[model samples]
Target: MRKWFGQSLRLGLAPDGLALVRTSIWPHERARLLAQARFKENNVEAALREAERMLADHEREGWALRVVLSDELVRLWQVAPPPGAARMADLEAACALRYRALFGASPAGWQVRADWSATRPFLASAVPQALLAQLQQAAAGSGFRLVEVAPQFVAALNQHRSMRRPGAWFGVVHGGVLSVAAFDGALLAAVRTAPIPEGADRDWLEGHVAREALRVGLGRPERLQVCGPAPKAWASSAGRLKFACTLFEDELDPLWPDSARLAMTGRAP
Candidate 1:
């Protein structure tokens, strides 16, 4: 999971805004969106200022925090394992080399995390070190502990990785961004993200799938599973999308639309 136990504050950072959620897994596995605050200005720097204020001292103590940054804030890619790879150094060098190619920048200012592999292509993500430092300082000053910080799509993938199939790709949509992981049989071939277009519908999704498949050098999938706060029209029975589309069934997506009246366990709150 998040490499930790017990409850923690879930901070969702997106371009639209930022949200602070209270998540608990001890007594019950549930999350409630406690508060959302707009940034003073229209950028991530403003969001950081708002977060610093939100974490100011004298109010809360001894809490752990997990900051989930959005796709627009971090970079993600798939790194193929090198041939005859027999050590971790090979994997690290491959990632570092790929980072320069993909980002055209040295990895000095970035902190990288990856699913290391010497036999198959694995996922890699990089986050800005400045962002982490600011959050960590604020949390520590407020008597809170910084437990884990991750990109939103990476977090989602880790949560539902077991559901991934051999041929069908997986996508996570949120805050007008779609993060896709395209696979070739059992190997992860590509990882990419695209912004959701305005007034997007089933037709748009078909086009998206076709384009992503071509870009990743894969055949069109017969079916795909997607999750997030997607449009309801995507689920319409009539004039269905070309491919078989299935909602990535999750505990929260089941009750997300009208969760106010129902609990995470399908009982009245």
Candidate 2:
């Protein structure tokens, strides 16, 4: 089980769109879609309009909102544990500093969110504060309170809680980017996101996977669970490395919204 972040409703923000869903934890209840809309990436006006439209369609008063942002807008990193940090603020500062050093960019207007539950605690995301503020304002105006903002990859992983196997690798290929996450039992071992080169072939995909696994010190995974569109020859290629590949056909759909809903309810998709 995961710690409660306090929200039963979710709004998924993608580089190209947005989606909203309400979830129920009751045995006999089911999750429902409230509203969804698409917009061009980096178009602030279009995003705002879609957000307004989604909020206007639902009676969201008193409903908690969890926003899962696209990986394109957030950066995830795995860093060493902070030394002698005694408070959350101190830890956050250290994380920010590390992020700045890694990316060579100012963290002044970036919101850092970390997860300290693993043996090698990591920063889950660093998102632009301005973007977050816009989302918050939109939710507030809609009579809903924004409770949490998370990365899309993290949300997608949360949806596979039941399928998580120790010493396994999981990948999601979406929006021309591939996100690979390694897990050992309930602890996240390593995570990486890389862009897929245009017209990449099966060999290139296999090589990329091998390199990522090496970077994470996993050597090779016995199993690789994958979602989203992938080359048809990927399974056979991975089999050469002794990895039993499993693809979740259902997860191949637009994932942002489904991941958001799963993140809120901790339910398998």
> Which regions of candidate 2 are displaced past 4 Å?
1-8, 26-34, 82-90, 117-121, 183-189, 197-204, 215-218, 228-241, 249-269
- Tens-digit lDDT track of model 1 for 1-269: 45445656766765446766666766566777655665434598877776777667223577777777877788898899899999999999999999999989878888999999999999999999998898899788887888888777777777667777656777777757777888888788998788889999888888988999998888887667676766666653665646676666555534342211111211112
The CA lDDT of each predicted structure is: 0.72, 0.67
lDDT of 1: 0.72
Best by lDDT: 1
Deviating ranges (above 4 Å) for candidate 1? 1-6, 26-30, 236-241, 249-269
For every model shown, what is its TM-score relative to the native structure?
0.84, 0.74
Clashes of each: 0, 0
Model 1's TM-score against the true structure: 0.84
Pairs with backbone N, CA or C atoms under 3 Å apart (clashes), candidate 1: none
Q: Residue 120 of candidate 2: its Cα lDDT?
A: 58
Q: Who wins the TM-score comparison?
A: 1
